[model samples]
Target: MRPNLLKRAHSHNKQTLNNLLHSRGTSPHPQPETISGHKQIEEETLPKYNPDHWYPVRLGEVLHHRYEIVVKLGFGMTATVWLARDLQADGNAGNRKYVTVKINVNTLGEEFQKGRREIAQKLFSANPKHPGYSHVRFMLDTFKVKGKHGDHLCIVYDVLREPIDLCMEKFPGRRFSCPKLRILLPALLQGLDYMHSECHVVHTDLKADNIMMGLGDPNILDHFVQNQIDHPAPRKAPDGHGRVIYTSCSDFGEPPNEAVIASAKITDIGLAAWGDEKNTKPIQSNAFMAPEVILQAGWSYPADIWNLGVMLWDLFEHFGLFDRIDTKPGHYHPEQHLGLMIALMGPPPKDFLKRCAKASIYFDSDGQFKHPEYIEDHTFESSIVRLKGEEKEMFIDFAKKMIAWVPEERWTAKQLLEHPFLTKEKEFFSATPSLSRASTASISSMIPSRAVTPGIPPSSSPNSGPNSSPKSVPNTTLLPPRLLELVPSVSSTECESSTNCEETKTEKLATNNEKSTSRTSLSLRPKMESLVESNNEPDVEVPNSKRLSVNKANKCSQDIIDAILSKGKNHNHRVSPEAK
Candidate 1:
């Protein structure tokens, strides 16, 4: 019932259809007071309201003499979702269970309704033993409500908290943090595998919006219903309209934790189709359409993979993968989209062009884009700047396997499960230097095993040994920014206490801090010189590959030492007392 909750719900509820050619109307209209004396506020588009279009419902109204409407959750073009309590359930007001009731528009064709029912039946009949079975959401119950214009089909579902995108907004950049991404990707892939392999369903629409974050505590819904009863939702009777438009309240209780995030499920299968079928009607949101979908060629499960690829970019980068608009605003065209694809991945292959039914429209005889001017100079390497080193490499490799020009080239959901990016047991680090156990493992993997020995002094150092040079420490750009920020400034008093006045040893400390969720430790030792010398051991011969690996580790370790020295230099601390 909070204003921000209502605003976020309003933005999410009014889901629009993004396709090839259609656009919705958003003409300004006058705001007047409702019969309840409240200001006329908009929920869904007022123009969309009609007897045959959007079905009208009132708050506190009991549908089917069982489910009591509690609050509006969200609305799409075809249906409006509401939070309702099943009267048949056992508990009292504070303990009763709640379900989401999706009231379909009266105008949703009979075929659309039938398709949903069939998919639900198939999903229920499918194998439940699969790990992904629980990750994908299905209908709990289905019923009907006769309206003034026509009978509205109502489907019941387990109440989910909110969309994944809204949940990701809690992080720093309105994107999923590395830790959350690790939890999200595998679950999504499993769900996709189950939907494709077991259920034979292709979720044509796969995006952040379609994925709903699952509820953690069962009591959250009960709390929500109790709050609604205590503080009734905003009701507005439109001027001369017969029904009151209740503003949707989507907040379940509090912000979700890691468990709630991990429980996220793939939802909204209205556009889902059987993978075995060759039904080739254009599928997927315009920005996420696969090459096959855009070319008007036949598509199947692989198209979903392509959709996932684009959706990943949106999730991580906080932007769409392509620019679909032409010179005019709100005008999205396939030509422009294809042009951008060319810029990113180069022109479609000759074999791929031959397979496209509409290839001639966008591509020349030699498979070049017809509108070269529309192609922006962009590449995957240039776009993904948030990640670096192994993380960036693995991500790009994982994404390239899915966003291939040819649908067949895209890896299947099951195959993608084993991708190094997903399967690699790497724990993503945060902006903070307080490394988790998982973070330690990830960093250890980055450093070569032979190159590092914790708590042990190096045999010799290239700089500090018997033969050493008195040169200023080189620049330190290699250390990660987060790690570099932790380097303490070397004060003159602190330097005076050092055993070796020529060099400052990065003090190592271990603390049993119960306040942090994970272990907080920072070890910045200048052991890179010893690592370099060890690699050049005269009697011990090593492989060229091993040498390269050790050199890489040396460089990485050297960065930390340089960063520590640089901090000392900036503070004007003397490396040794030999010179004033």
Candidate 2:
């Protein structure tokens, strides 16, 4: 084995072992039992492997007699993504490029055509000059493969590294830093703007799972292919299903610090529809769904804004903005969902409700919500506890513009790009200079005037120092709050600037350096405590003057909310945090 590969494997194993033994009795759930003569591990559901469903994909199998499958990247409900090498490219093996091939399920042959056409037209025909055009994932090529069950559509795309949510795991907490969000949020909005304005498309499903990070270094792909060549992915021998099921092994390795928030592209336009396409079909995940969608009112680009707003909590706060605990298991409760919405956004507007098809069912003639008990007494400002001071204020202001109860009230993607959260760059003080002071001089005087590392202005500063501290920040994203807490206090040192020295007093923070789990647990305690306190605080009732025509939508009898709101199939195959 190559020395670097061996070292990486050793380090990975060490980390795995360490995580396994992290908290003794508190170790993660055991893996599923292996079948006889085979490792029983988590992969695609065995039941899905049928003659008329999944296309039996094999490693090294060349599709269309041109692209050779290298390894399984990921598997989803309707398709499987694989890394493939172009056999006809004009280069040697080492110099040739790779592309991701998404083979759709046989069952989706007819249903996926509209989406496929829109994806191709919107991405390819979009104005190249539109700033968001580049941020949106576009198709390189498309074709069809005839399988034994039926025909399957094959889509070829540029090999993006991983999804935004997966990238968040590299940080101490699974969240992006403010600076990183400042960089990535605009790119996402720009992409949305391009889809909405230039392409006349509305991404019905806009969440972390659909947003992927652009590949930064070409060498990462080379290493992945080399790793596969050295150690082939393990596969289950043909059993009752009579098809080999190979475990996915698509890892681009830990992204270089600069790659964190380098660029985020909106992928998976499979569920997207044209903005002018008038359809009230239920869209967006339950928690992120807009009120207009749940109420069966007409929706358009604003729905995406609402989806993005709710998703922001997941990205920055490490939790869903709306609570989703219903009596039914793996089902959506519309009443419960609406109650949460009412709490954050206050009651929906009476005028808007009048236009809703099912408004009467949820609300009385007077516009009072029928199930007022389900409502949680909270506001957007109170629900957000992680951020504080001006940062918190700016975030709430930005969110309010997107999550308005009325869809028309929501800001357009282009207008949102100019918000303070996206426009104003957050500034941070540089790491303190570790200098040895002479005599008993002030520690502040010993250190040079702290330099201001400006929040990245455009994509020009790729090699900036602040942008290179992924380990210290949230995946080259944000400065780890834990590290900021550890900044030592120097007595009597007059700081040149208040930003550098405001938090000089020693804080009574407990730290555990023994194990990662311990550190994670200890570090999260304060945040959780703060969250609990915020929840327990006295509920400030929304005054009658401010409350909208107070009403609730009656719960739909059928469970329409998609099951497993947070569940996602990742292209990059790393040990998930839950598995660890």
Candidate 3:
């Protein structure tokens, strides 16, 4: 007989054997036998392999007699995710409902159990419909499965598509377009705001890997699953546990067109903590690590903002913002990282430097940086000078606010959502079929202008064309006074000069023929001494309404300056009084 015929015959024989055993009132799988207390103790003490190291469970195995293990999704440090079919699905034909099962290693003992229980309570007790929970992945149910290593804790979640890192891998470069960035940043921030404020949880770890692309349409998922069922991938050999590891056939193609890739959800809350909980272990990924975290100073929600900012830079530029190659073995150079930060953003505030435990290692007593070689002659503007259109300005401006040396100086997620860079109206999200027409329109209206111009390099000249200039389309919305202060706006002098020219253009032209060209050239100068001298000599009275706006703007600026001074003044303290 041919090999294919032989395999079919063998499968038929195995099925027949299982049927025979079922008819005889016995199970094909082995059952556990009762043992004495001494024997049980001996078994517990014996050397046992971790179930996750090898395939702990078999394909077709009924977990808790409801979810039948279908394929292995992936594995993590302490857990393994599997795609499983729900046996108890409500009377739907052909297609069965599938879920992701996360099985965590349970050999970690009592302390691990206590921590797991706390996390479970926090996750399970929360309201899923809350706005804070908007971009967060919600748990469905949990159970335990007894294995040779120990009992494994299994968590069930709605089947998500893939991680943002995986999505980036499929693209030509490991970068997403600005439109995608707009969608992704807003959703992530909304989730962060919810987690920080309503849930009172701090996700110490925020990165591309932890953020997952949401499975938008049920039909699309069903189709993907159906494809797997029709054309299954080849199975691998069984492990020591006599279980074959089956790889999932689900194809997570480049960022899928069917779903809004921006509709991402933050995952893996195992490392997360309650807002007030004190953390001993170092947190955050190396590249995204905040200065406070590096210095072992007490950090809070602001650390997360710092992480988000770095993540955003990675998303936009497809490179790590603070990534450095260490010259010394067994040690990362903090001075190099700090030096780069200082070079890009001015120097860290004196107060921020005072709190650093190893401040002398990098900075002198006078707060001047010691490592000049590590510093690059780069500012946000100089770095993004190549970028075409207003993106160069907007990106640098947005980044400056987030990558501040002082944590409190960083914009909160809520405040960042209102930024013009993110709010610019665009039709990018409209291409996603999953979003409704109304939703597409609503999102587009919030944006000030489209930031993305495909195939154009950042270094491209801003004067390429009239259409290329973002200034051609004026932003109609009046920004809040507070936001106006944060962002560099049209200077009052420029505004006054422009307004005056617009009102008196015809009158000026009529009065001057030879002087018209000279007058135009002089007026264009930003701080012409003659113009300034003339304006200063006049004692003009301002309207009360105009005076009120100016006063408010000044107050806002003063308050910001005072806050910085206050932070610097209390740098010697263990915990800043302002933090309280």
- Specify the highest-TM-score model's number: 2
Runs in model 1 deviating more than 4 A are: 1-43, 46-51, 92-96, 239-241, 323-330, 427-580
User: Can you write out model 1's per-residue Cα lDDT over 211-263, one digit (the tens) per residue?
Assistant: 97777776677677667666656555433446566666676656667678777
- Could you tell me the C-alpha RMSD of candidate 2 in Å? 17.9
Candidate 3's TM-score reads 0.62
Compared with the true structure, what per-residue lDDT tens digits does model 2 show for residues 371-435?
89879865776767665443454566677767777665555676666553453322211113321
Model 3 bad stretches (over 4 Å):
1-55, 91-96, 123-129, 169-174, 234-236, 239-250, 257-259, 326-331, 382-386, 426-580
| Model 2 bad stretches (over 4 Å) | 1-43, 46-51, 92-96, 256-260, 326-330, 427-580
Give the clashing residue pairs of candidate 1, or none: none
| Clashing residue pair totals per candidate (backbone < 3 A) | 0, 5, 12
Higher-lDDT candidate of 1 and 2: 1
Instruction: Sort by TM-score, best first.
Output: 2, 1, 3
Better of 2 and 3 by TM-score: 2
